[model samples]
Target: MTAPQDHAPSDVPPAPRGGAGPVHSDTTQSAIRQSTSGMPTRPHGDDVHAAAGSATQPTGQADWSAFGPGGSGTAPPNTDEADRPAFEPDRGGTASADHALAEPQRVRRLKIALMVCGAAVTVGMGVAIAVLMEEASPPLRVGVASRPTGSHAPAAPPAIGGSSGASGAVPGNAGAGAAPANAIACPLPGGPAACPAMVAIPAGRYRMGSRRTDPDAQEEELGGAERAIAPFELSAHEITAGQWQLCVNQGACPPPAQPPQSSTMPVTGISWDAAAAYAAWLSQQTGQPYRLPTEAEWEYAARAGASTVFPWGNQLGQRHAHCGQCGTLPDYAGLAPVGSYPAQRGLYDMVGNAYEWVADCWTPSHAQPVPPAQSACHEKVQKGGAYDTLEADVRPVARTHGDRATPDVRVGFRIARQLQRTEQ
Candidate 1:
């Protein structure tokens, strides 16, 4: 999607408004609900194993009643060896006249007995084979179509793509029974004011900083190491002026130095402190914890499953972002409206819009311990280069910092909310 140039500021639609509940985008609510609703509950591995075991065992004994006399379900008592009749042949290999009558009767009885015994053996073998076939079969899965013989195991849940260095889990999955942030539409708290659309970011681990070997790597971003992040929800787009205005209307946030011409434009000229205040105000209204994303989180989301220098690729492609000298924009001097560009990992304007405030202090280098947020703060971290940023500066690893209380036209912030879990 490209920025709207023909439409006037008034022609641009206001941001979506939600009713009193968990907030999400209006477009995605039905889809998310449908997806989650239709999604079959995954069977536990242990449960599947248990089912397989039960299927293999013999269900019951085979009926052999037909072989029993009078259908009594029991075989007749065995005859003693001495009582069994034996045939005798004369010198010519033929039965003599005196034993001819007895021989015929004995032979008939012997053949009948043998036939009954053979039938019993055959029935027993059939039962054994049936049990074996059941044991070899795999447990059936619900909502998944059965594969042809010799096919691979049932397919896994579709992978929801996310940041690099970690496999994607279900997209926008918060927990059991919880919908993804973008999919669930709810009302904004306190009034009918519009709320920022949120995207659910799955939990994953990745390298947090740049390596020393890289030419564009910053000293502050070196000595990077793998870091684990928890599941959380972030605004799909940079917080728009219309959303901030709602907070200001409630007297919960400070006014911007210069109001945006269009409500859809990302709100700038707001201090880090003001951003934090807006987060707190949102938490109070929605009864959900809201705050700024951590520095590591910002990088991970910006990368959006890409390991390249830029989320799109190693090079800064045209119209991918709004940055100075980045090219492909009608106006590089000013910020475009929110969602003016494509999304990464379902997040929009992560790299080139306004430099976003993160919830971390500006340490000199990666070697030093990160200062705690509770402690006295000096300069806070900002990420995702701004409109005036060069191509090299508009990377996931790029960072800038300023006094927490000071506001700049090049800076703005997004909101992140915690994912709550419920008992299954």
Candidate 2:
């Protein structure tokens, strides 16, 4: 008798190429239908050929080759048509007619492999997403970490008012004995509440000059050493017009060569001697130690915890400050008003607002140290490059010297105060 042809179940969908969901077949459904009809199922042995030729073949069919008497779980080897078995197994397992009811072995293995692969893909995606999120947002730092004198490790800028007292009040200013270890810079006791706004600076260390490989390095900015700065307070903004005018009105300072259009704008064209006189007048009025920042202190403050050429970064960005190559805005003809740009570490206009005078006397190079003083200085150092200053010259380490008696439209100044002993 002729062997019957093997046929695949209609309910089972084709297996996917790569790892996909589990494979399902109609093995259980076929058995349920046959048992419900009270039909005695024919064995897959010699009855298939007789059933096929007599037109009495069962419609409810299942693959049972793997569990049959003479069958293995895998497909049989290839042979001639006449010698081959009547049924062939699907990709997962062997096929046969000897057994009436049994699940194919290959289908179970395919389902297990697909389930494991699907689980692995899900876990891999979860880990990748978590890593990306962490890189996108770093945590904020609450305290300053000490660094070796010249270490180039990047430091995060502290929050406004520093990690110490919030109101710019330090324990040192309260009394004399060893102050609380956490107390930072504050205005001296008895200072007016409305004195030029100041931001407390934490004690820190930094390299004092341009790197040896800098292309813009000048003789005066080279051969410098590392410096350790004590805690102090620096003016939040460059000295404004109203602030300078107050000094002139009290007769403690000479009138400016040109009046500023707005009281909030920085006062310019003031000689170094005149700027020093204003600082002295402010100290007397507010009862705070007010003076020009030393050259080293000015550079350190301007850097604002950055190691790049510019405080913001290495490249020049639009509207960062009012410099020639730093980009322009429609607001002003000359200098933008004080606090017009975003601040760094609570201090505004550290660079590119105006040329600020420092407390150092101008020497040919940084090889020799110049002591900071408010008097008896011939040539004074200028920092924080002016609005018209070139981009190449608008870095923390860049400097220019001016005659102490001369005042230019581009030159201006800000003040700094030292932190006193903390309260015991």
Candidate 3:
């Protein structure tokens, strides 16, 4: 008389009464298969128990509680979600599907961060390198000399031979403080073609003494003042042995006590009187005035329009001049070839190589008044320093005294000519 009991389809299994057999829905079987695709199978006895426990489960109820203790419907308590695998599903949706969707975005963010860091490091290195380069460079120096004297004199005109009493005198108003308009270069007649050329020095006033506070200035070089000079022509280099040999071959000059290293070496070991005699002979032959440079004229030409100790700068360097500290050769290895070092204003060896004999009577200091005329020459002033001298002694203001008749290997002389005006 009871209603017929609801029965499952003939292809499906039936649920047991009183929960004696487990009931498993299609969802639970599928979830188990997916989760355990690669897992080792359980023992035959455990498999039978799991099959019986899950056989009668209903659909839409695939919680892991079925496999937990006592087959209870409640799921196990979990405190940390991070313990779950990326492939596991959550309450909201399948966890593996959500992870697959968000993985590309996480990778993209990581790549962006790495790119930004790399770019920042590159920029930082570039900035550091730029700072280093700036620090390694030297500062430029400009306008280190005193103000110009507002004079622009032309180069000397070529020399012309003429008979006139004024040709031997100082030209261009020597004592009247007038700038010379012309300078002449008179070539030595019958002299060797290798003789050093002459340079015209324009008449101008220049500071005649070293500054008292200068590091290289000596006590004798102090008390400097502005001095006026007349225009003149000076030899471009110290007189070489070859140039002097021309006079020697003609019996116009005496032979050196010791032979020079080379014909081009500067003629050293010549006395002041011998240098003056050479100048006189050259004047008579070339028909122009030639003599030793006066003390003021020697300094002006050596300064070469610079107010520095050397023509180049206060500090001495190898390429500028040769001295004991220059390191080019052994100390006092004799003289170097003319123009072996640098030149300023067409003059060489103005600071070193050989001490130059100037046309002034030796005075203890520049403070002493120079006599208007020569009384009797005792000691002559020598400007420029020799190769064996200290670098500080090579300064233009530095001076030393030597006997006029004594010949020294370290002493040499350069000739100067009074510039003359020619009638058109």
RMSD of model 2, in Å? 29.2
- Go through the candidates in order and give the C-alpha RMSD of each one to the true structure: 23.1, 29.2, 38.7
What TM-score fits each model? 0.57, 0.55, 0.55
Off by over 4 Å in 1: 1-186, 189-193
User: By lDDT, is 2 or 3 better?
Assistant: 3
Write down the lDDT that model 3 would get. Answer: 0.52
Instruction: Give the poorly placed runs of model 3, Cα more than 4 Å off.
Output: 1-196, 330-332
Ranking under TM-score, best-scoring first? 1, 3, 2
| Candidate 3 residue lDDT tens string, 268-369 | 778788888899888877787889999888887777666555676667665466443343222123346667665665577786666688898876567776
Model 1, range 1-424, lDDT digits (tens) per residue?
Answer: 0011101111110000000000012222111111111111211111111012222333454344454556443444433445434753234422343344554455557657867876787778777765543232211112111122332221321222222222233232111111236434345643432666677776767676677876456666776567677878888778888889888988988888666766767887788889999999888777778899988877777776566677777776666765533442223224566665656666777876566889988776666768774337767887775543344456677665667777755568998988888799
Instruction: Give the top-scoring candidate (lDDT).
Output: 1
- What's the true lDDT of residue 393 in model 3? 51
- Output the TM-score of candidate 3: 0.55
Judge candidate 3 at residue 20 and give its lDDT: 7
Error (Å) of candidate 1 at residue 207 is 1.3
